[model samples]
Target: MTAHAAGRYATALFELAKSSGAADAVEADLSAFRAMLDSSPELAGALASPLHAAEDKVSVLKALAEKAKFNELTLNTFGVAARNGRAGDLGKVASVYAALAAADRGVVTADVQTAAPLTKKQTEALAASLKGAFGREIEVRTDVRPELMGGLIVKVGSRMFDSSLRTKLDGMKTAMKEA
Candidate 1:
């Protein structure tokens, strides 16, 4: 149900952004807002908590949007969501909106997690390989997961290729036990 609501909000925002030729700006705004949510737990709680009144949430969102200098479309979307009591779904809405925008542009997002940060050249190589394999332009989103120990994991859409050292070690342990 939350996803449905998020999708509806995202679709509406996407359509508006597309018509206004501000999709990229809106996407950047949402990405920055999501990063803000990640860094500020209080802000997230304020937006998501039922204890906060709708009007209060809208005001908070407005102030933050203005401070961030978000695009007009992004500010309006956030305001509407807050007023509709869907402010909590903003993160999900951003994700959905990004997917919609990428699909419209024939681009695919690859979520890559590596034990350490990838060099710029490595990132470009990986993206190129993915593009060749998928036959579509690839956008590589990378994260450093130290727990992985080594290697990398890549997820594109529903498909995941897990080649992390942690997974390999686990598999080896299982095999040794069976032996």
Candidate 2:
């Protein structure tokens, strides 16, 4: 249900942004806003908290928009979400909006996890390699997972390429036991 609501909200926002020629900017704003929410539990809690009045949540979003210098469309979209009591699902909306934006631009996002953070050059190189393989432009979002021990994992939609050392070790252990 929440996912449905988020999709509706994101689709509406995406349409508005596309028509307004601000799709990219609005998407960036939403991504930034989503990242902010992810990094700030207190802020997310306040916005999603029933203890905070609806209007109060709206005001908080307005103020945060100002502080963050969010684009007009982005700010208004936040207001709409707050008014519709969908603030709690803003992150989900942002994610959906991102997917929509990427699709519109004919780009695909790859969730990449590595044992350590990649340098900008390395990121670009990997994206280039993936683009060549997938035959589509790739936007790589990266995560550092020390537990991976080494190597990387790439996930694009339902497809995944796992080269992580942890998985390799597990496979070897399984093979040994079978032997």
Number of the top-ranking candidate, with lDDT as the measure:
1
Residue range 1-179, candidate 2, lDDT tens digits? 99999999999989998998999989989989988997898988887877877788889899988998988988987888888788888988988899889989899989899999999999999999999999999989887889999999999877999999999999999999999
- Cα lDDT computed for each candidate against the true fold: 0.93, 0.90
Pairs clashing within candidate 1: none
- What local lDDT does model 2 show for residue 166? 100
- Candidate achieving the largest TM-score: 1
Residue lDDT tens for model 1, 1-179:
99999999999999999999999999999989988987897988889999999999989889999999999999999999998899999988988888888888899988899999999999999999999999999988887899999999999999999999999999999999999
Model 1 lDDT-worst window of ten: 94-103
